[model samples]
Target: MDASVIVAGAGPAGLMLAAELRIAGADVIVVERLPERTGESRGLGFTARTMEVFDQRGLLPRFGEVETSNVGHFGGLPVDFGVLEGAHQAAKTIPQSVTETILEQWAAELGADIRREHELLSLREDGEGVEIEVSTPEGRRTLRASYLVGCDGGRSTVRKAAGFDFPGTAATMEMYLADLRGVELEPRMIGETVPGGMVMVGPLPGGITRIIVCERGNPPQRRTEPPAFQEVADAWKRLTGIDISHAEPVWVSAFGDATRQVTEYRRGRVLLAGDAAHIHLPAGGQGMNTSIQDSVNLGWKLGAVVRGTAPETLLDTYHGERHPVGRRLLMNTRAQGLLFLSGEEMQPLREVFSELIRYEEVSRHLAAMVSGLEIHYDVGSGTHPLLGLRMPRLELSADGRRTSSTELLHRGRGVLLDLEDNAVLRRRAAGWTDRIEVVTAAPAGAAPGGPLEGTAAVLVRPDGHVAWAAPGSHHDLPTALERWFGPAR
Candidate 1:
């Protein structure tokens, strides 16, 4: 086999998956159609949960001076995220190009083979494995792998070739996005509605301003060529009475509110993640964040399977877990589209939503939804309140040294955190020590009623979700271990 896994596209999801497979000691190859990085960024920031995910891998420092914000919005209505517990504000200004660069470098440092100018032409998945045909700069070639993953954006060649069902509502409206210089305008960070449509203008680094123009009554069009800058400037003038024709355009593109998701994330040896699995309106800046997370959730499980450390059934969990999240993603983005993009007909709904958002419960729920903190998988039947949830950040004292739950996960290994030093619990999980790390720790500087107050111990999956907890839980530790980390050695 050319590699244990072949990942199509070198965007954030594909590069992240490659790094994850390498972390699990599996050979991975990443193929990208682009010969070089575009340096143009459509996604401007990431959700709070993505920040924590990057922290778990010791990748925060790579970005160099990140700006986080406690303030955010849902459908252009203000909703503070500070109300949620353990929520670090979302990263405000990191560009998608920078994110891709970081992931590509990290994956390369981890020994992932990344090939540029390699376009996937065809793929065939049989009973044994998947074979792919690719067109390189020199010529066409065939590559084999145990599995193939598509991260090639909304129009996925792998998803199409593998016959994955992508069903959803088509685009009803289209908008223009441009990043350019030589123009200065009042900041419309949360977007502003005008007579005929809406417009948003925000400043980026290097004197460039990002503008989004959404002219109402403009139908969605399937165009092979990008919209000209003059068209965008004309729309801006018609909508908001602003003339941006003098601005020098750096990058220009168009998008639509076309919502869709794959019926299945995997079909035999071929799988999907990121935009390949889901696509929706770029509301609340959740598209790229969700795509990045899809890779994280699938990476460890696929790595385990390829390394022969876990059963193939574990792979099924990727679909079982993420497909629902993708469904929710589509739902939320569609709701936001109605709230933010529709005409005056949606004003009442927006008013009701705004009033409801004033309530702390409503604010917390919406904050968690957009920030991705509300994601909880059905790991098992347990009422520990922490089960199937991403493990909260905690300060721990281990061997007279201070560490954090996030630090323990830097190695990308499952963690059995024994908070009370239970010998029985430690012994119960000893058989899986080779695959899981056992860290005896206790709360350090924790308040009386903190999130982990009643927890005696917790088994955290490699992806940072709680697999099992000891307090007020009936599932045995050994059973939980066997279910997640594979059978005991």
Candidate 2:
């Protein structure tokens, strides 16, 4: 095989997956049609969960003084994202272009082969691997790999070529987004509705501002090129009575509320990630965040399979896990569109929502949903609270040394943390030492009676989710190891 995996597109998801695969000791190649990075950014920042994902790999310092906020909105309604304290706040200022550049650099530094100006033309999958044809700067060439993943956006060629069923709602309205340099506007971080429609304006770095306009009675339309700046300015005036045609346009584009998701994330040897697996209204800035999380989840699993450390069936978990998350993403974004973009008739629903959000429990629930902290997978049968949930951040002291749970995951290896340091438990896990890391430590400071209160030993996946917890075990350590890491070496 030319490489263990071939990743299509150089967007955030593709770059992130390539970096992860490299960390897990897999040969990866990333192909992108664009000759260079597009400075335009559709997503302004990432969610808190995505922040943790980056922090797991020690990639945050590279961004240099990230600006974050605990204050956010849910469908134009004010909501505080600080319900969970001591967690990373939502990054609010970094542009998507900067995110892509960082991930591309990270992936390249890890020895991932990235090919620019190389476009995937076609792909055919057999029982063993996938063969792909690409149009490159040199000429057309065929490349073979054990697996292929498409991160090429909503209109994914890999999803189409592989015959995956994309079933969901279609676009109904078109909205304009533009970044300007010569205009100074009031900050509408969420959005505001007028008699006609809604408009949003927020300041950015480098004396620039971003604006979004949704005009009433405008239907979604297809165009070969992006809408002109004047069109966006006109829509702004119609919605907010603001005619700032003098604002020098930096980037202009249009989008829709159409939502869609594939029935499955994997098909034989071909797989999908990012917008290829799911697309929805960019509500709560969840599109890019969800896409990045998807790549992180799939990266380690794919790497294990390619390196012959795990069974091929492990790849099936990617679909079983992320498909449901994608479905919920579509559901929540469609609900938000109704609340944020609908006509006056939605005022009553908005009022009801506003009233509901006043309760502390309601606020916390909504905040977790938008921040991606409430995700719980069904890893297996166990009553432990930490089971299938993200391993909460905790301080530990091992052999008089200090460390945190997040720091241990920087190397992209499964962690079997033994709080009691049982000799029998360590002996049982010795066979999988090559694939998993064993750490013996006790909680530091006043450890609360939370998920790890009574746990004696905990097993965490490379993606940061707790796969197994000890206290009461039905399957035992050996069984959990086999279920996640594969048969003992």
Candidate 3:
């Protein structure tokens, strides 16, 4: 394919999308501004939802080695995401560097030209594609791509050059952070008493502890702004009752919880994603997780458009589906701040949750919110069972071997399960051998290992969402195929 996608940031979102596009047979180029990996790692963990997306592509084991989990909650309260109503059951704590490294490696394997120390200086969209101006070590050069994506953090030069408006409020409250050594703090345990203001200390995999100090009236500071290490250390001791007076500092920075989202995530042929698209408080470890998922959600649609198999409207769905998710992300993070900031005066609210914890539903919902597994869309397909729902990662049986639904998608193709091998079902996938892979799932209840009930012959999209499915149907198959696979064979 002569057409190429120029991705402006090498962060998780950009890298993930680049990998997806390359895997789908597109020429992809990823650009990063940093000359080298920053020893200072931010976005220290990913929710189970993010891990599930990776696991589907056989990318989990690559990242899981450096990851730690069994982490229970935020602030001082306990979290139980395993009870959330979905396939993703656990959260994994991994450094942003490791996450970026895994994605970079994956993209490289797919033959994406990932260039570092090359910053996006300017860009213009024409009828043919987008022409991006870059400033590299070799001086400046212009590159053309059929599409351009800005994953270049909150301050994206691509978005700015394209004249997109990022509308949102700046932070009013500020928090300081310090990654220190010689500090002894349990990774999972955080104080439940951090009302109005709170401090949290958690273990990052490398024996390094992360300390976050937030206060109600503290002045907001840019992330680049440095805070006094001793002051943060003293405050940590006061809040957690742990003295880390002699801990050697690794990295210290301050930031605000102020949140803002772009009014529109896309501007013409160039799109904004990840931190480049939306940023909010660091609450709930969502900052990075949401961005990675955004590209996953859009990657396939972009690929299909480039491949000439999907309508132009498909690309628009990236903004349609993702913008609302971004809105929810902003709101969810704000609510998390309240929980972390609740003081003695807010004791009643805690008492309510503590009391409500007995009811499994409330805890399950909150857990779902944090994990981001609870997201569902408006099903624009004129009403279908699986239209707006995520596919349940289930184990299925084939000619003899046991396999997970994710296994089939590792090669990045759509799957059509034929439950009974019904003649009509067999004929439904007659054409498009190049686009869809057909597989016959075992008879109804006989599927293997953790199969969700009421699923028979599922149609999995390239991005892993369930495009069309049937609980029990021999005749409804054709209609499902048309809407999802774009007027099937």
lDDT of the candidates, in the order given: 0.90, 0.90, 0.74
What TM-score would candidate 1 get against the native? Answer: 0.98
Candidate 2 lDDT over residue span 84-174, tens digit each: 6667899988999999999999999999999999999999999999999999989999999999999999999999999999999899999
Assess the local accuracy of residue 488 in candidate 2 as a C-alpha lDDT between 0 and 100. 95
Give the 10-residue window scoring lowest on summed lDDT in candidate 3.
443-452
Model 2 scores worst on lDDT over the 10 consecutive residues at: 446-455
Candidate 2, residue 426: CA error in Å?
Answer: 0.7
Model 2 bad stretches (over 4 Å): none
Q: For candidate 3, lDDT tens digit of each residue in 1-489?
A: 234788888888899999999877778888888897676667877787787788888887886454435345543457665566445655555777788888888899889898899888888788778988888999998888888999888878887888887888887877777888876876534444543467666776668888778766777655555777877776666666667878988988778877888888877688888888888988778888899999988787788777767665777778988999999889877766766675676667766766776566876777777777777765444334565566666667777778767787888877887766666766767665567888876643444543444555677777777766666333365565554455554
Model 2 Cα shift for residue 423 (angstroms): 1.2
TM-score for candidate 2, please give it. Answer: 0.98
Off by over 4 Å in 1: none
User: Residue 464 in candidate 1 has what lDDT?
Assistant: 94
By TM-score, the better pick of 2 and 3 is 2
Model 1 scores worst on lDDT over the 10 consecutive residues at: 189-198
